[model samples]
Target: MVVKSEFEKLGLPTISVELGEVELEKEITENQKETLLKNLQDLGFDLLDDKKSKTIEKIKNLIVDLVHHKNSELKINLSDYLASNLNQDYNTLSNLFSEIENTTIEKYFISQKIEKVKELLIYNELSLSEIADLLNYSNVAHLSNQFKKITGFTPTSFKQSKDKTRIQIENL
Candidate 1:
């Protein structure tokens, strides 16, 4: 809504405005682009013009949505899901993501899942077993193992501890 309002204030017709994306009814002048860029920057957003950067951002957005918002297990492999969603080959996406992010897509996905686990743990609304089930882990053991590996603290330990550190989704 903020983005849409910004464009509307400038009298620009927009077809759609979504997280990390916007569709304009028509092209604007370079001056308009500059003004929009400045406005977005002031609002803590950056205009991504580079193809590779946009692809990376899309990958992050999809994974974040899946882990944070979706409530079911992924029916397909992550590679297949990403490829199908982005309309690109799996290998290309993987290679590009690794090159740009300095981490494999699998690692990033795991990190995101771990973050979600942290959030659920902090809420104290679900048991470890339930969390494992909710996150589509094979079992509690697997979730604990991955959580320990990434965070150095088991879920139970983290939950019981005074300090629980959760990385921001964008930082992850």
Candidate 2:
């Protein structure tokens, strides 16, 4: 929405837009591109133009969609899901992600899932088993184990404690 408004402000047509990306219907001049990039950077966004940078951004976006938006049982393994969505080999994608982000893709995916779990827990709308099932965890024990591993507290303790701060999704 910001991108659309910003582009309209610049008299450009926003063809498509999503988190961390935007597509213009027509090519803009270099000066316009610089101005847009600067404006977006001021608003805490980046214009990912290079191939590798765009790939990395796509990976993050897909993971976010899977973790936060889908909210249902996964029909396939994450590796296959990513591979199919990206139309690339899983090993290649994993290597590129690790190289750029300094973390494994699996770890990134887990962190995203854990963040979503925290969100659901904070909302107080779902049981632990439901949360686990929604997030594709095999069982509540597995979910609790991972929650403890990443957050240093079980789900119940996390809910009951007075200080239940969660890491920002961007940080994860």
Candidate 3:
């Protein structure tokens, strides 16, 4: 929404907006493209003009949303969800993501999940069991195992650590 607002602020007559793509009422010139990029950058956003980069960003955004924003566990597998959402094949998407990120899509998704667990753990409002349930973990042990694997700290230890800071979403 804020990204779309930025486009409208530029008086370009925004047409549509999505995770990796944006459309304007008319085509843009080189200078206009530069200006738009600059504007988005100023707001900590980027205008991806390439398919690969855009697809990567789209994947990241979707994972972030699923892990952080969604209220329930996904009914479909991640591969199916991503392919259906992006209208791309799972194998192609997985290959591209792995090649560019040097990490599998599953690993990136797990990282996102770990980050969310860190946030929930730090808040202290929810019990570990509650947090596990909220994040759709099958069990606290499973969540704790994955959390320890990623962060080298169990959920309890993470909460106890002085440096409980989380990675920024853009960094992920």
Judging by lDDT against the true structure, name the best candidate. Answer: 1
Q: What C-alpha lDDT does candidate 3 achieve relative to the native structure? A: 0.86
CA lDDT, every prediction?
0.91, 0.86, 0.86
TM-score per candidate, chains pooled: 0.94, 0.93, 0.90
Please, what are the lDDT tens digits per residue for candidate 2 over residues 1-172? 7777878888888878778778889889999989988988888777778988888888888888888887663646888888898899999999999999999988988899888888888899999999988988989999999999998999999988888687777787
Identify the leading candidate in terms of TM-score. 1
lDDT of 3 at 2: 84
Q: Which is superior by TM-score, 1 or 3? A: 1
Measured with C-alpha atoms, the lDDT of residue 160 in candidate 3 is 92
List pairs with backbone clashes in candidate 3.
none
What is the RMSD, in Å, between candidate 2 and the native fold over all Cα?
1.4
TM-score quality measure for candidate 3? 0.90
Ranking by lDDT: 1, 3, 2
**Model 3: per-residue lDDT, tens digit, 1-172?**
9888877877778778876678789988898889889989998888888889989988988888888887574544899889988999999999999998899999999898888888988888999998888877789999999999988998998899899989997887
